[model samples]
Target: MTIAAIIVNYGTGKLILDHLIQIREELATVPGSHLYIVDNLSPNGDAALLTEGTTGMDDVTVIGAPRNGGFSYGNNRGFDQAIADGGYDHYYLLNPDAYPRPGCLKALLAFMAEHPKAGLVGSRLEGLDGHIQSSAFRFMSLESEFASAAKLGIFNRLFASKRVARPPQDEAHKTDWVCGASMLLTAEALEKVGLMDEKYFLYFEEVDFQRAIIKAGFEIWYVPSAHAIHLVGQSTDMKDGKQSAGTAPDYWYDSRRYYFEKNHGAAFADKADRAWAWGKRAGGLKSLLKGQGLSSVDRDIAGLEAARKRAAS
Candidate 1:
């Protein structure tokens, strides 16, 4: 089967060049596969670097975006070009820093061929140290919003069923969504669900798209057999580690608000926002009473309130 691998480069040209060999080897497992790199007009000269590095490589194509349109925009640019070129059965969304293991592409393709209902499948992601990361997740809800922010053991246990992060799986299984870093999407699914919502500049776009996929009667799965070493947060330092509440960039809050509102409407988004606010407040009060200080989890009431105002107006 034919395949097209897409790598969206923001400021990670070196990483792409670094892992190009591994990527090529994986793609070789599927004859006639091609690679596309979409640079988001990075200010740090990534576009030129990628263009020069990929020069004379017949299997590789580098497309520069008109503007820094973020992740979804870059991927769509690659997808559009792939469509024009024609004859690709599957489209792989791969991050610049992710290195797929030997036979990774073949494994993902095997599963897709076996399960015709699965519209999207993601590879298990591991750090360089071989530690597994959270790849699959359930959709966000009121209970999940509270449990995620509260970060209390008791609340986590109580809301275990609603928690968004799914434990690492040893085998392939159905899931609500998977990380966009290493996903395999069938052309059929994209044709049905449409391209990703470009409104999300960085985050939550994958979840929103996967939600639409399921809504359109397609399944999503996580395949551990297809492994990739993901250097998480290499492109975006904002997501490197655990972030304190309210400390995220304005775009992040805007994306979060948009995801909720777009998926569940204004009333449901408001309710989820309130639930998160109260949970963060409760966590903050508990920390203060214990004299642990509020260094870790600060309440995001003000930031979220500002997001709400922007959404309303």
Candidate 2:
């Protein structure tokens, strides 16, 4: 099978270069695969340096995008070129911060061969410490959004099916979407669904993309046997440790709003905001009533309100 890997870089320095190196090392024996490092108009000189440094490597190319058009734009550029070049049967969207283990690409390729209907397959992502990251997920919904944000045990148990993050199962299974950190996409599936929606500046593009693919009658799967080490948030710095996220940047909120609005319509997106507000309040009330915690576990109420407002408008 012929495969192409697209890595989007934005001021991530040697991390992107190192990722390219590791990908080359792992895929040395795997044939018909090309690697692209797309520099997304990073402000620093990293773009020039990255382009200069990696171009000499076999089958490696650096693309300098004119604008700093977020992750989707960069990946879309790579995908476009891959399509024009032809002979590529699949496109692997690997994050700059992620490193695949030996045989990772081969495993994904083999799985696609076995499952002809598989639209997208993602590797089981392990952090540097070997703990499983939340790679596979359910698509977002009103209840699941509330359940995740409320962080209430009751809600988690009640909404487990709708929950966005799925724990890696012992066996392979189907899921609504997989994280873009190390995603594999068949050329046919991509051609059917089109490319990643560039509306999302950072987050939720993968969910939106998968929705379109599944709507096109393709299946999304999680393969635990194929693995990659995601140094979580090294590219974006959105994460700090296991469970805690640093204060989210503004684009994150905009992307969240855009995802809901684009997929569910503006009116339903408003309802989602209301649902989230009510969910937070309900969870806090339940916690207070049970004496399990404080009056309110939703400490980021202001942030949520602002985010919802942003989405609503």
For candidate 1, the 10 contiguous residues with the lowest summed lDDT are 237-246
What would you estimate as the lDDT of candidate 1?
Answer: 0.88
Instruction: Evaluate model 2: give its TM-score.
Output: 0.89
In model 1, state the lDDT of residue 33.
92
lDDT of 1 by residue, 1-313 (tens): 8899999998899989999989988888888999999999989999999999888988999998999998889999999999999848999999887889888888999999999999999999999899999899999889999878787898999999999989998989999999988999999999998788898898888999999999989999999999999998777765622343327666677788999999889999999899988888777888888888775455367778888899899
Q: What's the residue-level lDDT of 44 in candidate 2? A: 92
Candidate 1 residue pairs that clash: none
lDDT of 2 by residue, 39-146 (tens): 898889878888787766868878889998999999999998777777488888999999788888888888888998999999999987889887888887888878
Off by over 4 Å in 1: 240-246, 290-299
Best by lDDT: 1
Could you tell me every candidate's TM-score relative to the true structure?
A: 0.95, 0.89
- Number of the top-ranking candidate, with TM-score as the measure: 1
